[model samples]
Target chain A: DAMVIQNPRYQVTQFGKPVTLSCSQTLNHNVMYWYQQKSSQAPKLLFHYYDKDFNNEADTPDNFQSRRPNTSFCFLDIRSPGLGDAAMYLCATSRFGGEEQYFGPGTRLTVT
Target chain B: SQQGEEDPQALSIQEGENATMNCSYKTSINNLQWYRQNSGRGLVHLILIRSNEREKHSGRLRVTLDTSKKSSSLLITASRAADTASYFCATESDFGNEKLTFGTGTRLTIIP
Candidate 1:
């Protein structure tokens, strides 16, 4: 099945240490997105790549960065992990324009 | 806030009952969509309704959009235990950027 995949379903990192989460898709969708989701809350958009053009949400912290090295792969790098940053990181993909999105199983990050 | 709000933050219903969740947004949207997320899992796309369309259905799921009121509703018929999850409504704005603003999700529990 063509779907999105995320590596390290559970990640543990020390405080102030940098952590990288990976996402890849076989769907070959033109748009890739990263979102942060805390317990009992909605997934918050962090940034997205629309065919190499990165669009970051205004409220996204500088510590959060994303890279789409190619069409199928995207990475989320946390410059400095914080306790509050411990949450599920979700990756999604969709075609251009207003369309439905397909999401990966998500990476659960734990900052110690 | 660009994000939408879903009413009845949580719901509990018996199996075979119908479940309905409502969402309201503040801005003009090009399309509205509904998604389901299992506990500690990624979101699954349920249905999508364009602004020009009023209603859409897929199997047991039905979605209704009212662009004039900036609101949408998702109805799940003959709910099963497998349907227990958090449901969210997302909107694609008129900007056509495909940036979706998701509503506060509704957690549904189906008691078998």
Candidate 2:
């Protein structure tokens, strides 16, 4: 089955340490997205990649960055993890302009 | 700010009973989508209703869209314990962008 996959479902990082979360898809979607979700809250858009172009949300912190090395893989890098940054990071994908998005299982980040 | 807001932040119902949740958005949307998320998990797309469409059904799920009111509703009939999860409404703005703004969500608990 074609689906999105995320590595290291659970991650722990120390304050000010850098951490990276990875997402890969078999769906061959042209758009991939990264979302941050805190407990009991909506998933907030961090950024996304349409093909090779990166689009970051205006309110996204400067400490967050993303890279799409190829069609199937996208990575989210946290330059300096903070306690407030601990949350579930989700990765999703969809075909160009498609309304339905397929999401990965998500990576839970614990920043100490 | 969040574009969509779901009402009845939490709901509890017995198995076999139907569950309904409503969502309101602040902008013109190309389409509205509903997603389900189990506790501490990624989201699963349930249904999508386009601006031109009023209602749609899939399996036991029924979704209604009211463009004039800028609102939508999701009805799940014969709910089961497995259906216990958080339901969210996401809107795709008519601006031709694929980014989705999600609602806070309604936490539904189905009593067995």
Candidate 3:
């Protein structure tokens, strides 16, 4: 099936350490997004890439960053992991504007 | 601030019963969509209703949107145990942005 894929479904890192999560898609969508979801809360948009254009949310912390090397691959980098940052990070993709998004299984980050 | 808020934060029903979830948003939207998420997994797109459309259906799922009230409802008929999951409503704003604003989800549990 043509779907989004995320690597390392579960991740554990020490406080202040840097960690990176990866996402790839076979759907060939033009837009890819990263979201942070805490337990029992809605997924918060961190940033997204439309083709090669990167758009970050206004309230997103400086510790969060994203890179889209190509249409199929996108990466999220956390410069300094904090206890509060431990949550499920989701990746999603869509064809263009106002379209249905397909999501990956998500990566659960645990900061110790 | 979250754009969408789902009512009845949690619901439990029998396998053969019908489940209804409501979502209310605060902004003008180009479209509204419903998604399903299993425990510790990614979300699956269920249905999308455009701003010009009042109601839409896909198999056992029915979605109704009332732009005037800024609210939408999802009905799942003949629910099964396999339908136990969290349901979320997402809105694509009229701004024509590529990212979607997700609502606080409704956690539904179906007992067999």
Candidate 4:
């Protein structure tokens, strides 16, 4: 079945260390998004890629970055992990102008 | 920033009982969608109701939208223990943007 997949469901990183989370999809959607969800809070949109163009949310920290090497793969990079950054990172995709989005199993990041 | 707010942040119900959650948004939306997330997992798209549509149903799930009030409701009939999860409402603004603004989720617990 066509779906989105995220690698390393749980990740542990030390303070100030850099970590990368990966997401890939088989749905062939035109847009990919990355969201950060703190415990008991809404999933906050950090950034997204529409085809090859990157769009970042105004309040997203500069420490967070994303890359989409191809249609099927997108990566999130945290330059310096902080304890406050520990949370579930989710990846999602959808066709252009499509309201329904498909989400991957999220990656839980633990920053020590 | 979150665009939607779900009422009754947490709810508990017995199996076979119906569950209903309401959401209110702050902007004009092209569509409103509901999503489910099991603990420690990714979100699953449940339903989407467009601005021009007042209500829709799929399987045991029913969604209603009130554009004038900027609100929506999700009703799950005969819910089971497996339906225990967090429910979120996301809005797609009418600005032709691809981003989805999500609401703080409602945690529903179904008891067997």
Candidate 5:
């Protein structure tokens, strides 16, 4: 049962405060991705780490950053939380260039 | 901008009935995939259909792709109450390492 795991299924943060969401995978997949999904909207690609190389989406705001310090662990950091930033943050992993992806239980962030 | 759009934002049907969801994408895709998400949880990979493959099936799930329309459909037969969830379609472009672009999801409720 290799699985992707996300910590703190629910998070509450105050506006202008910093928050961090963590994802770890036991599948040991080569590629890890972060997506932000707002209510009834598409899950927007934030960025991904292929091994250790971090690739950010062109439209991703500068306020958002990701760190993949190791193969199985990744973190998404919001430097300054905003109300609009509240959404379900999903973590997904797959073998490089593979068509199938496995997703972790998402972290739902609530910015107050 | 959302690269994919899923039809029938929400659907409610009786258990044992067939459920179908459709997705249309804007660009050339290397592959199209379907995923399921339970309430407030992560997405579970359902199926993947390559750009060249016209149809694929797994268990009670059937996926069809039409490159001309840049569209794909997922059909689930003999669906149960457990099938009530959000289903989303994601596309991988012909670009590097197959980064996925996901669509707005379809919320399916199976009435028991």
Candidate 6:
């Protein structure tokens, strides 16, 4: 089955420490996205890559950043972890202008 | 405000019953989609309804889209315990942007 993969299903980081979450997809979709999901809230789009073009949400905090070096891989880096930044980070991929996106298992980050 | 708003933040039902979730959006959309997420897991695409299409069905899942009202609904028949999850509605805006804006979501619990 075509799948998206995320590493370090659970992550713990000290306050102000920088941490990185990684994702890879076998589906070979052209667009990759990173979302932050807190409990009882909608998954908020942090940024995405359409091929090599990086599109960040206007409200996304400066601490969040992404890198999509190639079609198969993408990474989310938290420049400084805060308690508010602790949430499940999801990675999704889809072909450009497609109806559905395939998501990975997710990385749960805990900022202490 | 979120592009889509799913009513009834939570639902509890017995197995074999049907589950219905409604989503209302604020703007014209190219398509609407449903997705499911298990606790601590990423979303899985369930079904999609394009703006031009009124309704679509797949197996036990049925989705209806009303472009005029900018609302969509998802019906899951013969629900099971395994179906307990958070269900979300996502909308692709009229401009053909690939990113899907998701709703707050409905948490469904199927008691077996």
Candidate 4 fraction of reference contacts recovered: 0.80
Which residue runs of candidate 4 sit more than 4 Å off their true CA positions? none
TM-score for every candidate vs. truth? 0.98, 0.99, 0.99, 0.98, 0.96, 0.97
Query: What TM-score number comes out for model 5?
Result: 0.96
Clash pairs detected, candidate 2 = none
lDDT of 3 by residue, B4-100 (tens): 9998899999999999999999999999999999999999999989999999999999899999999999999999999999999999999998878
DockQ numbers for every candidate? 0.85, 0.81, 0.91, 0.80, 0.74, 0.79
What docking grade applies to model 1?
high
lDDT of 6 by residue, A2-107 (tens): 8999998999999999999999999888999999999978899899899999999999999998999899999999999999999999999997755589999999
True contacts kept of 2: 0.78
lDDT of 4 by residue, B1-112 (tens): 5799998899999999999999999989999999999998899999999999999999999999999999999999999999999999999999978989999989999999
> Higher-lDDT candidate among 2 and 5?
2
* Tens digits of lDDT, candidate 4, A17-106: 999999999999999999999999999999999999999999999999999999999999999998999999999999975468999999
TM-score of chain B only, all predictions?
Answer: 0.97, 0.98, 0.98, 0.98, 0.97, 0.97
What range of 10 consecutive residues in model 4 chain A has the weakest lDDT sum? A94-103
Ten consecutive residues with minimal summed lDDT in candidate 3 chain A?
A93-102
lDDT of 2 by residue, B24-101 (tens): 999899999999999988999999999999999999999999999999999999999999999999999999777999
Q: Candidate 5 residues A1-112, lDDT tens each? A: 8999998899999999999999999998999999998886767889998898888999999999999999989999999999999999999999875468899989999999
Clashes of 6: 0
Candidate 1 Cα outliers beyond 4 Å, as residue runs: none
Best by lDDT: 2
**Could you tell me the C-alpha RMSD of candidate 1 in Å?**
0.8
Question: For model 1, what is the error of residue A18's alpha carbon versus the real structure, in angstroms, after optimal superposition?
Answer: 0.6
Q: Considering lDDT, where higher is better, how would the candidates rank from best to worst?
A: 2, 3, 4, 1, 6, 5
